[model samples]
Target: MTIHTETIVDNGVNTEALIGARGAFTEMPEAAAFTFRSTCDWVSGTESSNAINGYFGLGQEHEREETFTIASDHPAVFAARDTAPTPPEIVLSALASCLTGGVAAVAQHRGIQLRKVQAIVEGDIDVRGILGMDPDIRNGFNSVRVRFEIDADATEEDIRALVAQSQKRSAVFDLLTNPTNVHVDLA
Candidate 1:
């Protein structure tokens, strides 16, 4: 088995662990209100930031089943061909893309020419647990594992170093491995 690796620079900070380190601030946003708009069929509303809207039709037949697409300045595309992405699936995709992009960005910045980058992502989530039907189990994914395939002319050590740097800088990777408080207020 060929062990693919990447190199990384450690700045003594594991960004993943600092998920909620900022805590609360004395001053909040002055507006306390925001707005966003989109014309694409795949995206709309302020929640989407106007880049793309994830769409799914309504009614009982569409419950938990609908197609999703992306409408951006570049192209209108489908997120998942057969069905819409659930909340957890979105997180998985975010991590996968982050690592892939991070590797390419770091390699280019460091003058390393990479031929290709590919990633396979997997996560474990128990529906019963997440639905609160099982009190003894955890509600979120227990763990996530990613497999990356990279094509570069660098040596084993060089590859390892690059991968390490990508991991350290990957924002989504940090979010998953870290804990944060999500507050929801209903008016």
Candidate 2:
């Protein structure tokens, strides 16, 4: 049996010959790496679209099988059987985590040994407030109160100084209390 191949011709010229003549010179330029550095503009922005697969290291198999993603974590934890964690709970978690790390960093910097550090964070957000029913009431948490129990041997002054420094230096805390601008572009 004989096999036949068709030759590509353009204007009575062989296409392959033309391409070979062009060689590497006709190829497109090489691509370069595009690097970017970004900073968070919001202190307590709730992260969305993180596959509702459980905690760290848990794969998609653990995620919700339903089309309607179920909320877990804060307010959701406190809500009824069908509800999910609210935005306030996420905020409280961020603050609590920041405070814990800040205290630890300050103590480490000052050469103070920490026996234990505990914090109780209480935040109250009116359901109606979040629902946007009343214009006079705040939409978010009315107030976030934190009670810290430091077990370090350092004096009260030392603890106070550490807390102040942490509050001043923490990026998330600053974002929460300050104004931020957001820019968005669609391709």
Q: Name the best candidate (by TM-score).
A: 1
lDDT of 2 by residue, 1-187 (tens): 9999754222222435434544633452221122223222222323332233232221112333533332433343334342345556657777877887877776765656677778788887776765679888887777778778887767999988878887887765775778768678764
Q: Candidate 2, 44: how far from true, in Å?
A: 23
lDDT of each structure? 0.62, 0.59
Q: Compute the lDDT of residue 60 as modeled in candidate 1.
A: 14
What TM-score against the true fold does each predicted structure earn? 0.57, 0.55
lDDT string for model 1 (12-125, tens) is 334443333323121333232223223334333212212333333221122224334432221124223333455576778889988887777667656577777788899997
Backbone steric clashes in candidate 2, count: 2
